[model samples]
Target: MISLIKLSEEAFTLYRDQILAIEKASFPSPWGARAFLEEARNPVSYLWALRKGEHILGYICFWMFAGEVHLLNIAIHPQHRRQGLGTALLKKMKSFALSQAIEKIYLEVRPSNVAARRFYTKAGFQERGRRKRYYTDTGEDAIVMSLELLDRSESCAERCGAAGVTFSTSEAQKDLEVSKKRIDLPF
Candidate 1:
């Protein structure tokens, strides 16, 4: 069974090495321990860890500003990739965004990451623009994607068109309840 938890300072202190290990394994240009620590300390950032029992399966970090959410980083452990955990994390984020009245969520992906692009596309994120040579490590162009969250009364399927994004409204509500129990930091 997988569970999501907001990464608190105490949790980070306890799982520092494990989190860094997963990061190094998942990303070509992984954030270092210090970077992760700094992000955890940032007031604008929110970090969440997906776990199976005591084992960390993945993590996501995002920044919320001016009625928008910016996905900073998200990755599932190599062993956990291709499962539904990524989608689950995204649904959780969407639920949280709606609760906070965030209008949109956006992220940049490397053009070389075809799988990520496909995943984002299937999740109803439209590629709106690009950044030339945005990746410092590889000088690769970045694809900018955005998803607009409709009003609660509106169906996501209508706004999403044929993107085929399917998230359970009940699941999102349940996630919201779980989040209320787990999230402790002031936003």
Candidate 2:
């Protein structure tokens, strides 16, 4: 069974090493342990690890800012690739974002990463744009993708309510049922 845990100080050294290994394997210029340590100290960012027993399968870092969550990095250990762990990590992150009142989520992935692109697409992220030569390490472009939470009001109603926004799951469901009735009833 796979489990996801928030990175803690006690796990810092191990998380750093695990993340670095996956980073080095996935990118031409991987962020080292120091960079990760810095990010881990930031209050606006969240870091998590996917683990199986004593082994870490992957890590993700995302920054929440101005009502949006920016996925800074996500890397799965080479040996763990193609196991759907990445999708699970992203789903958990999206749930986190919704719970935090984030209205949108964005990420930049290397354009050359076809597998990653397909995975993101399947996870409801739509390619919105691209940055030319965004990755200086390899002079490769980065594809920007985003998921809009506004369209997922039902999935996010709880957080919206906690934020005092007055959104409710029942209201959303009622709206959906009304819409379905409208469609079925025709003009």
Best by TM-score, which number?
1
Model 2: lDDT to the true structure: 0.70
TM-score of each: 0.80, 0.76
Candidate 2: tens digits of C-alpha lDDT, residues 14-63: 45576677889987789888778777778888877776656678888999
After superposition, candidate 2 runs with Cα above 4 Å error: 151-187
How badly does each model clash, as a count of residue pairs? 0, 0
TM-score of 1: 0.80
In model 1, what are the clashing residue pairs, if there are any?
Answer: none
Question: What is the total number of backbone clashes in candidate 2?
Answer: 0
lDDT of each structure? 0.74, 0.70
lDDT of 1 by residue, 1-187 (tens): 5567767665665567888888898778989877877877898898887766567787889999889999988888888788777776787777678768898999999988898889889878999999999999999899999999874664543332222222221112322322324332122
Candidate 1 wrongly placed segments (more than 4 Å): 151-187
